[model samples]
Target: MTIPDTGLRTEPGSFRDPTNQVFHLGGDVLRGLDEQAARDYRTLAGTEFFRTLLAAGKVCGTEPVDPLPGVPWTTVLRHERIPFVSHPYEWSFGMLRDAALLHLEILRAALDHGFTLKDGSAYNVQWRGVEPVFIDVGSFEPVREGEPWAGYRQFCQTLLYPLLLQAHLGVDFQPWLRARVDGIEADQLRPLFRGVRRLLPGVPTHVHLHAAMQRRHATASTAAVRDQLRAAGYSRELALATVRGLTRLVERLDHPATESHWADYQRTCGYSAEDRAAKERFVEAALAAGPRPRLALDLGANDGRYARLAARLADQVVAVEQDPGVVDRLYRRLRADREGRVLPLVMDLADPSPGGGWRGVERASFTDRADADVVLALAVVHHLAIGRNVPLPEVVDCLVGLTRPGGRIVAEFVHPDDPMARRLSANKPVGLFPDYRTEVFERLLGARCRIVRRLDLPSGTRTLYLGIVGD
Candidate 1:
C-alpha cells in the first residue's frame, strides 16, 4: 500500500510492526492502522475494561482520525506525544522492574476481556515521568483457546531475565540491554546463576527451565512447538497463572545498594552549606530571568538537586548522571513524589550515548536527542577537562550543541586552585590543560552564545555564567 503524503514522516524505529505504523504530521503523533488492526481495535475499544485502563493512565490515550485516502487503512489514531522518548536501556533498575509489572498488569487485564498481547517487547513500553504506560495499542488480539501465550518466551527474555541479572547478581544490565535491543537471553543469564543461587524462587522456571527448553528445541520448527503446546492443553487459566507468578516475582525484585562516589556527593563534596546555597540561588535566578524553557537538560545532575529546581521552571527536564546508584536514588524519589516533570538518566559525560541500530538512525545519540531550551552544567567542567583529559574548547562546544538557538545555558566554572580541580589534576603533569581558565572558557563560549549574566560566589573559586545561544 502506498503511504499518503500528509506531510507526515515515519519515525525510524517504528517500522517493525506492519499492523500499525506511527507517523508525525506537524505536532500530532498519529498511528495508521491496517484493516485487521482496525477491526481488533474496534472490538477492544467497545469493552469497558479498555476504558477503565485508559482512565487510570495504564494505557496511552488515543483519538480516532479519519484515514487518509489511498492509505489502505480503516482508521488512524492520534496518540499523546510523550515529552521525551527514552529507551529501555536508559532506564534504572527500578524503572525496568516497574515497566515489567506494568506489562504484566496490562496483559492480565487484556486476557480478562478475551484479548491477549501478541508480543512482550520492552520497547513497547515507555515512561511518563515515573509511571509506565503501554504505548502499543495494536498489540491486542482475540485470544486463542488451548494455545500457550505466544509472548511467553519474549517476556522472559525482554523483562524477566534482565531483572534477574541485576537482582540475583550485582551485574548492571544497562550496557547489555543497549547492545542487544531484545534484552538478555535465557542462556546468557543461566551461566551467571550457579548451584544454590539457581534455586532462587523464580529463577528455575523462568531462567534455567526456559533455557533448557530453548536448547532442546534449538532446531524444532515453530509449528512443532505449537502442536506440542496444543497437545498439552495450554489454556487461558495457565496463561493467567503464569502472569500472576511473574507479577509477584518482578514486584519482589529490587536494586541492591551499591557503593558510588556520586551517591554521597552532597555529603562528601567539600562545598560548605553557604556555598551550596549560593549555587542554588544562582541557578534559580538564572532560570527565572531566561525565557521559560519548555525543555531543560541538567548534565552531571548528581542527586537531582538542580534538576528538581529546573522542573519548577521548565515543562520537562532530562537529568543525566553517570553514576547508576545516584540515578537510581533520584528515580526512587521521583516515583515517590509522582514527579513526571523530571527524567533521571545514567550516562557518562566523557563518553555519551552513541548512535547505532539500522544505519545509525534507529537510535539517536545523546547530543542529537538533547536539544533543549536551557542547560545546567553545575560543577562538572573540571571532571571532563582535567580528570578526563578533554580540552576545554571541546567541552564548551558539546554543551553548545545541546542548546537550541536562543536557548540559555547556566554553567559553573571551577578554578584551577579549587580543591576539586586540584584533586583531579594532582597526578597529571602541569601543562596538560593550560587553557582551562574562566577567561578561556568565556572566550570559547562567546563564539556560539552571548553572555547574559555572571555571578562570582563568596568562595572565590567558582563562577556561574548565564549565556544565550546565538541566533
Candidate 2:
C-alpha cells in the first residue's frame, strides 16, 4: 500500500503488519486500516465490547477520520498518543508481569465478544503511567471455531518464559530481553530449571513440556502442525482454557527484589541533613530560575528522588537507573501514586541502549530518543568516569548530546576526596585521572555549554552546576 506524503511518516518499528500501518501527523498518532482490516474494524467498532475495553483502560481509545491528502485508506483511526513509548526490555519485572496479565485479560475478554487476538508480541503493549494498555487495535479479528490461538507459542516465548525465569531462577531478565528482542526461547531456557524447580506445577506443562514439544516439532512444516492441530480437534473452548491456565501461572509468579547499592542512597550516603537540604535548595533554584522544559531526563535516578522533583517542573520525566531492583521499586511507587508524569526505565548509563533492530533504525538509541529540555545528572559523574573508566571529556560530551540545543542541565561534580569517589578510585593510582579536577571539567563544559550557576554543597565534597547547551 502506498501511504500519502502529507508530511505523515510511518514509524520504523511499526511495519511488521500489513493490515494496519501507524503514522504520525502533526504529533498525533494515526492508524490506516486496509480494506479487510477496515471491514473487521467496522464490525468491532460497532460492538459494545470495544467500547467497554476503552472505558476500562484496557486498550487505547481511537477516533475515526477520513482518508488523508493522497492516501486511499479504507478507514483511518486517530489513536491517543502515549506520552512516552517504552519497550519491554526497558520495563522492570513487575511492569512486564502486569503487562503479561493484561494481555491474557484482553484475550479472555475478547473471546467473550466473539473476537480473538492474532498475536502476542510484547511490543503490542505500552505503559500509560504504570497501567498496561494494549496499543495494537488491528490484532483483533473474528474468532473461528476449531482453531487454536496463533499467539500461544509467542506469548510463551515473549512473556511467560521471561517471567518464569526471573521468578524461579532469580535472574534479572532485562539484559536477556534487551539482547534478544524475541525473548528467551523454550529450548534455551529449559535447561536453566533443575532439581525441585523442574517439578513445579506449571513448569512441567508450560516450560518443560512446551520446550520438548518445540524440539520435537523443530523440523515439522507449518502445514504439518496445522494438520496435527486439526486432527486433534482444537476448539475455542480449549484455547480459552489454555489462556486461563497460563493466566493462573503468570499471576502466581513473583520476584522478591534484592537491595541494590543505590536503592537506599539517601540514608546511606553519609550526607548530613544540612548537606542534603542544601542540595535540594540548589536543584529547586535551578528549576525555578531556568526555562521550563517540556521533557526532562534523569540519569542514574536512584529511587527517583530528583526525577520526582523534576516531574513537578516538566511535562514528562524519564528516569533512567542501572539497577533493576531500584527501577522496580520506583515503578511500583509511581503506580501506587498514579503518577503519569514520571516514567522509570532500567538502563546502564555507561553502556546505554543502542539502536539495532532492522537497518539500525527500528528501535532508536537512548541518545537518539532523548532530546530533553533539561537533564539531571546527580551524584553519577564519578561512577561513569572512574568506575566505568570513561573519560571525563566523553562524559561531558554525552551529557551535552542528551540535552537539546539551548536546553539546561543540572549536574553534580564529586570531588576526588569524596567518600563515593574515593571508593570508586580506591584501587586505581592517583595519577590515573590527572585531569579529573573541577577546573578541567569546568573548562571542558564551558566549551560546549554556558555555565549559568554553580553552588558548593555544605558537605564540602560536591559541587552542582547549571549550564545551558550552546547553539
Candidates in order: C-alpha RMSD to true structure: 1.8, 2.0
Which regions of candidate 2 deviate over 4 angstroms? 1-4, 219-224
Error of 1 at 7 (Å): 1.3
lDDT of 2 at 349: 97
- Over 1-471, each residue of candidate 1 has an lDDT whose tens digit, in order, gives 224655777777777778988877888888888888999999999998899989998889888988766555678999988777787778888888888998999999988889999889887787776778899887889898877788888787778888888888878878887887667888788888889999986888988988898899899998898788889988889899999989999999987658788788888878887889899998998888867888899999988989999999889999998887788889999989888889888788898888757777677788888889999999898899998999988999888999999889998999999999998999999778889988998888888789988888888999898999987
Minimum summed lDDT over a 10-residue window in model 1 is located at: 1-10
Assess the local accuracy of residue 135 in candidate 1 as a C-alpha lDDT between 0 and 100.
Answer: 91
Q: How much does candidate 2 score in TM-score? A: 0.95
lDDT tens digits by residue: candidate 2, 248-307: 888899886788777898788778888889888888787777667788999999888888
* Clashes within 3 Å, all models in order: 0, 0
